[model samples]
Target: MTSLRHNMAYLLTITILIVSVGRLGDTTGRRRLLLIGILLFTLACILCGLAPTLWTLIAARALQGLGAAIMMALTMAFVGETVPRARIGSAMGLLGTMSAIGTALGPSLGGALITGFGWPAIFLVNAPLGVLTFALAYRNLPADSSGEKTDRAGFDIAGTLLLALTLSAYALAMTIGHGRFGPLNVALLLAAAVGTGLFVFVEARTASPLIRLAAFRNPVMSASLAMNALVSTVMMATLVVAPFYLSRALGLDQALVGIVMSIGPVISTLSGVPAGRLVDRLGAPFVIIVGLAAMAAGSIALTVFPGIAGYVAAIAILTPGYQLFQAANNTTVMMDVRPQQRGVISGMLNLSRNLGLITGASVMGAVFALASAASDIAMARPEAVASGMRTTFAVAAALIAAALAIAAQTYRRRRAADPR
Candidate 1:
């Protein structure tokens, strides 16, 4: 539970704080806020390194999450300001590459650090990196305009609080049961639904809403967001279900399992820049179809083929597809956003991905358990684990197909309207 909380603290904070901080960046200055966030993150790393109790560490992690929220919210937004319109896809791809590199290296690197210098080293290592990042950003990032100050309407305090509470409730609802839905989860979910309704009502009336409700009316943006969430959910199944198949069905040892699992991230890291370049050359709309098709194929492969070779092949196809989708999807949203609205839009993009991940972890895990007919997954038979993996991925394939359908419909509508 302590370990889970440590992880959840960071995610929870990011989910709740990202949009608010992103809006703040738009009102204040993205560069200025980003600098402060880097400093806060660096300081929090040290606090986590020296924490005396588990709760203290969790608290520090949450603080670190706040810093991350600010940085992530603004990073993609910065691309719009700095990068040329034609190369936005490349920039988004570069971001995806960096993120994939971190994901790929984090586990192995952390294990090595812990072996050499204990668990604290994992947190402490980021201090120097954070400082270096801050220095680079401060030296190079563009300064905010004189007109960037907040207007008389100011920040929406009520909306921010309501949204935060609502998100927190939803996150807890998804996470609290350890994949078992109970009364508390149901109640929290209900609270979240009510909170969302209230938030919408308040935003409709407020002169300066946290999120402009009208934004959802844009079919391109709306459909893109939905596709992003669906794709993300399916992508997460790779992480949740593959391990059991590898370990129980194929009988790979822990070390071998780690190595095999690294395949996706490694592919993701390598493919990101190339994928972005493809988006630039072929256009985002075309690349979206290609990416979704690849994902659907990979998901189906997981169901049809067995053993580690099949697993590797599926991941090889799937990861690059993910990279392509991410670059194209981000570019589609950020390319033409109003300069003032970039930060909030970036936050919305990240929020969709995060929510998708959370839902995937809980709901997909449940599906696997149910399909396997296992009371306790860790103790389940090898055949059961394999069965579960197949069923889960079959569901994942369906999800990708749904996303693909959405993309196809979106494009058909676009062509019909424009006829260009």
Candidate 2:
């Protein structure tokens, strides 16, 4: 329970505040807000390191999430400000590479820090790095346009509150049950539904909205967001299910499972730059389909093949495809966003991805447990685990196929409209 709280605290905070902070950046200044976020994150790291109680650490982690939300929201928006329009894919790819590297390194680094120094060392180690990041960003990030402040509309405080509530309720609904959806989950879901309706109603009436309702009218943007969510859900299934498959189905111990799990992030890290360059050369629309196709193939491999070799092959195929899709999808959405709307749109992108992840962890885990026919997955038989693995990947494949169809449809629409 403590571990779960620790993990969820950060995720919940980030999911709730990400969009609001991004919008705030647009009004105040992305660079200024980003610098403040970095400073806050640095302080949160120190607080975490010195925390004497588990609750305090959790609180500090939430603070870290706020900082992370600001950074994540602005960083992509920065691509538009700093990079040339032609190299947008490359910039997105580099961001993806950095993210992949962090994901790959986090586990090993955290484990080593715990072993060598203590739990606090993991948090404390970031202090210096955070400072260095702050310095670099302050020195290099461009100043906000003078007009950004002059022409900005008032920040939508009411809309921000409603959206945050809606997201928080939904995230809790997905996460609180631990695979079993009971009354609490149902109630939370209902609350989320109501909140969503209220948010739309308010946004439609407000002079300055958190998300301009008309933004969703863009078929490309809407399709891209939907595809992003679906792809993220499928990608997350690998993270949630593969560990159990490795340990129970294949009878690998913890160490072997960790090594096997590392392969995905390693592959993702290696593929990020190449995937970005592919998008640059071939264009985002074409590369999006290619990435989805590769993912579908990878999912099928996981469903049909059993054993370490097959598992590795599936991950090797799936991971790079994810990087490809991420780079292309992000580029597609951000490439043409107006300067004023860039921050909010970037936040929406991250919001979709994060929501997908939360859903996958809950929904995919439920699917795996149900398919395995085991009340307790930890004690499930090898055959049962294998069955669950196959079923989960089958569902994953179906999700990817859906994403592929969306990509194809979006591409067709774009071609029809531009025909050049």
Candidate 3:
């Protein structure tokens, strides 16, 4: 229960702070915030390790999330700012590859550490690593952001608070939705809707809104964000459901399932740079379309076959689809916006991801539960669960198709306007 609380706290804080901290990096300096975030993350790890109570751990996790938000948002903004427009996709791809490696390694590493030294070691391990990263960043990076400083005429505190409330409510709804629907979930979901409406209303009025509404005025950027959200939904849903399908329906051992699942990340990590090269050469629209096509094909393939070979093929293909789509889409969005607004644009990208993740998990989980007639997915019959999995993949494919349509329209409009 405490572990779940900590996870929720981290997720909520991290998603909400990305915008605020990204804006701060735009105003103050990416270098300062980047180093500060790393230092704070390291210190928070130590605090988490030494904490005596569950509440203490939860609070520390929340703080750690703040640091992570600052680091993630600003780091991406920095890369977008520093890299040439032509090469930003490649740079983003490399960054994604490194992230995949770390994510893939974390669970295995944490398990080993917990067995040997305790849960504290899971966090203690970050301290030395964070120190190394901090040193490298300080020694190699410049002192100031490439973009101009944002005017501090107003800080949009109200807007930030509303945005935070909105995200928190949405996350809470998802968390509570894990069990049967009740008043609490309904209330939180209502609060989320209200908060969202209020955020848009307030942002349109505020001078220093966290996100500039004008940023989305560009068809390309807006379409890119939409694609990002849809693609992420499919990606996350597949991620959550596949293990159940593998272990239960396919009768694979946990070890074999893990290895099978690892194929996606490994393939994604390997293909990142190559996908970037394609994006640079062919342009983001072409790359994005190709990615969407690959994902759609993979979804269809899995729905039809739903066996070991099918799973492997789907992972191999869909992983690159996700990687390519993300890299190209990030490049597309950043390219359309002004350099000064890149921080917030980057934040919006991360925000879209968070929304997709939470929605995908909750929505797809509900579908699986309803279809299987079981509260716990693990307890569902293999054939029933397989049927649910097929339905889920079909939905994912439909989403990709929708995104591709939007992307195609945006591409057509852009090409017609530019005529370059």
lDDT of 3 by residue, 140-203 (tens): 8777844455455466788889988888887788768583568998898899899989988999
Ranking under lDDT, best-scoring first? 2, 1, 3
Q: Residue 80 error for model 2, in Å?
A: 1.1
For each candidate, give its TM-score against the true structure.
Answer: 0.98, 0.99, 0.96
What are the lDDT scores of the predictions, listed in order? Answer: 0.91, 0.93, 0.84
Per-model RMSD to reference? 1.0, 0.9, 1.6
Indicate which candidate wins on lDDT: 2
Comparing 1 and 3 on lDDT, the stronger one: 1
Model 1 spans > 4 angstroms off: none
lDDT of 2 by residue, 175-205 (tens): 9878799999999999999999999999999
Better of 2 and 3 by TM-score: 2
Tell how far residue 146 is off in model 2, in angstroms. Answer: 1.5
lDDT of 1: 0.91
